[model samples]
Target chain A: MSRLSINQQTVKQLSLPELIRACTAVGVDAVGLWREPVAEYGLVRSAELFTSAGFSVTSLCRGGFFTAADPADRRRAIQDNRAAIDETAALGAPVLVLVAGGLPAGSRDLRGARAQVVDAIAELAPYAAERGVRLAIEPLHPMFTSDRCVVSTLAQSLDIAEQFPVAQVGVCVDTYHLWWDPDLDAGISRAGERIAAYQLADWTTPLPAGVLTGRGQIGDGCVDFPAFTEAVLATGYTGPIEVEIFNDELWKRDGAAVVAEIAARYPACVGTAS
Target chain B: MSRLSINQQTVKQLSLPELIRACTAVGVDAVGLWREPVAEYGLVRSAELFTSAGFSVTSLCRGGFFTAADPADRRRAIQDNRAAIDETAALGAPVLVLVAGGLPAGSRDLRGARAQVVDAIAELAPYAAERGVRLAIEPLHPMFTSDRCVVSTLAQSLDIAEQFPVAQVGVCVDTYHLWWDPDLDAGISRAGERIAAYQLADWTTPLPAGVLTGRGQIGDGCVDFPAFTEAVLATGYTGPIEVEIFNDELWKRDGAAVVAEIAARYPACVGTAS
Candidate 1:
């Protein structure tokens, strides 16, 4: 249980304060948080709340949408990401997960859009490194390539991350997004120390409409969690193992119950004795 | 127009006879067929109908689902594929597309399942070759890796296809599935003469439930058709370019209108002057 962390998204129904209290009661010592909820609860105050409860903020949710076609929109996105970097630093999170946005509206140049992502990250890496926050590029599943993130493979994310200093930019390995990858084991091994954050979510079928909130709980789907965890561990990563599921059904349940269930399911997946 | 072909699935609402009439009316010289409807309309009769109408059977829709755990089930799948090869030969189709099935139920050994696909293909490749039918392995999008197909990349498809003789086993390249791949350009180039069929379908957002029937018609989504066609052409593949969209909305419309629209949209995507 030393490495276990419950991502705030796993219990989206809980407020920041309620989340901290629930984690304390459930004996979860760490958490991964989202930008919107932290801002809503007041960034500094939320940071203090976590500190007071002796909880470590493992990572900040996101900070990239660099695929805008308009020059002005691209600049604005960069600015927004800089602000997100500051927030990550303020919250004492070591990593800021970057979900490289989808293709711009009406633009079919996927290669061009991906080039823009690399350029945007190069510009942001220095800012993040200076602030002591690592930018973790999260490669979404290929299904989200058009509408969400164009970085659809762990190798693609590494292609961008390798262009920057390892301490500044790294890849976020999430099982839900990469479970289908044939080269996943090799990709994970290649990620090595470049793995900034490791996340777990199961892949359930008959993917819900929109496919955004369809992630299953740890044990509910087909992902081989123990194998996935073993691969990440083989990378020599000793950081927090965050369970971040985004199911509509899970969101409706009590936050405390959700966290408790996650805690219970963590050991079997990560191969750690409970 | 000579190189243009319409897959039967693009206008699934039409019966075999109605589809043949609609394609003939639209001046589509070629067609890719599905097994179920062809069987329903009588395989021999369907072949005769296409031949009488001066239509070339470009490729047969499917012939693989070889990931079953049971020995009997695996043998049955191989037998079914042999029958499909016979149908492809009888229909005078040059290629038989294989959508490799996903992991066996309650199993999480993705690598093992993929290995099984390679073995199954090897078992059927000789039979297909004997019938002068090329087994075209279709690499479905990674999203379908768990449920629909395990061959989730053109490279993976080629990995298996290359194991057998190129004349016996090749690959089906569908823009909808491969467009998101960062390695697509290189994969297409590597595929070279191993590309047995070239398919076109755009990638639309807000994927409908099940994700199977969510493929968009040409120019309806973000896939850069001209670019994709150029890549395939660069590989020296001058085969029939089939338009195969699986859209629920399109299925609700009139079949003749759908074929007409497909014909109208086909030239621009394939780089042919209208």
Candidate 2:
């Protein structure tokens, strides 16, 4: 229970104040937030609210979209990411997750797009490090490779992360995005301390249109959570385990009810160590 | 032109006779086939139609689904696959493509499901070889890992293929399924002689529900087709390059127009050598 955190997207309808109240009611010690919601609630006020309620911000949702064909657009993306870094710092969140952007319009050069990601991250990592925020590269599923994030595997994320200081850059391990990988266990082991954040969601079938917001809640799909938890625990990772499901059905329910259900379902999914 | 083949699914509305006439009109020398349509048209008659039209059947559409949990169902799948091998031989197709099935209902053991695929292929390879048919493992996109196919990358398919004689087992390389992989070139180079069927389709976003029939037409999306063709050709593969898109819009169009569009679009996408 001490290690469990509820990502706000899991209960997207909940207001910041309502979310804090629900977390307190459910005894959740931490929360992961998305940039838009935090901004909507006023970043400083949200930060103050969480801090006052004795809840830690595990991570800020995102800070990357560096692959653009236009040079000016790319520059703007970098600036936006810098703002995200500042937000992470203001919220007292140690990790800022990055979803490397997809291929630019009419550009089929995947390698070139990937190189841009590396260059963008290299430029941003020092800034993040200086602000005391770790940039966590979250590899989306390969289904998102064309339109969302070009980084589609933990190994690929690590390849980029290894080029930087471990304290400043690392990979985010999310089961929903990586459950099908044959080399997952080895990648997780190699990630070790470079795992800046660990997230939970299950792999469900008949993926929705756009393939986003289809993540299954833990125990609702085919992810072997115990095995994943064991693998992460073996890495000596004692950080918060955040539930970050994005199902449309789950989002439609009352926020408190969703939190209650998550609390009830979480214990069996977490490994023996937790 | 000699190396070009139109997979039936790319112009699925056409009957066997219409497909033959359209391919002949378009100067396509080969056609890849699906089991249901061929069976519907009469396997012997479909084979005769292609042969009479001087068309080589590049490969059979599919012949794998070995992840059933029930013993009887597993046995049935094996038996059905053996029949498919016979069909491949009867059609004089050198390759029989396999889409390894997904996890068993309610089972979270991905490794177990994958192991089952290995065992099923091991059991079927000898029979296929005896029929002078090479079993080509088609690694589907990871999006299909849960419900459609567990084999999700060319490397993983090669790992299973290497266990058998290359003459008996090979891999089907489809650009739509593998364009996202950073290691694709290396995988293709390593595939060298084990490359059986090479396919083409572009990667499009906002994927429809089920993520099945949403493949973009060639040149309509972000896949770098030339690079893929070059990689495969670098491996000395002088085989049929099949265009196999499964777009809903394409499916609704006139079959002859679809083939004509494919013919026009294909020249720009194929390698210089082809």
Highest lDDT among the candidates is held by which one?
A: 2
TM-score of chain A for each candidate?
0.98, 0.99
Backbone clash pairs for candidate 2 read none
DockQ of each: 0.88, 0.87
Error of 1 at A146 (Å): 0.7
Kindly list the interface RMSD, in angstroms, of each predicted candidate in the order they appear: 0.6, 0.7
Query: CA lDDT of each candidate?
Result: 0.92, 0.93
lDDT of 2 at A135: 97
lDDT of 1 by residue, B96-131 (tens): 999999989988889889988988987888888888
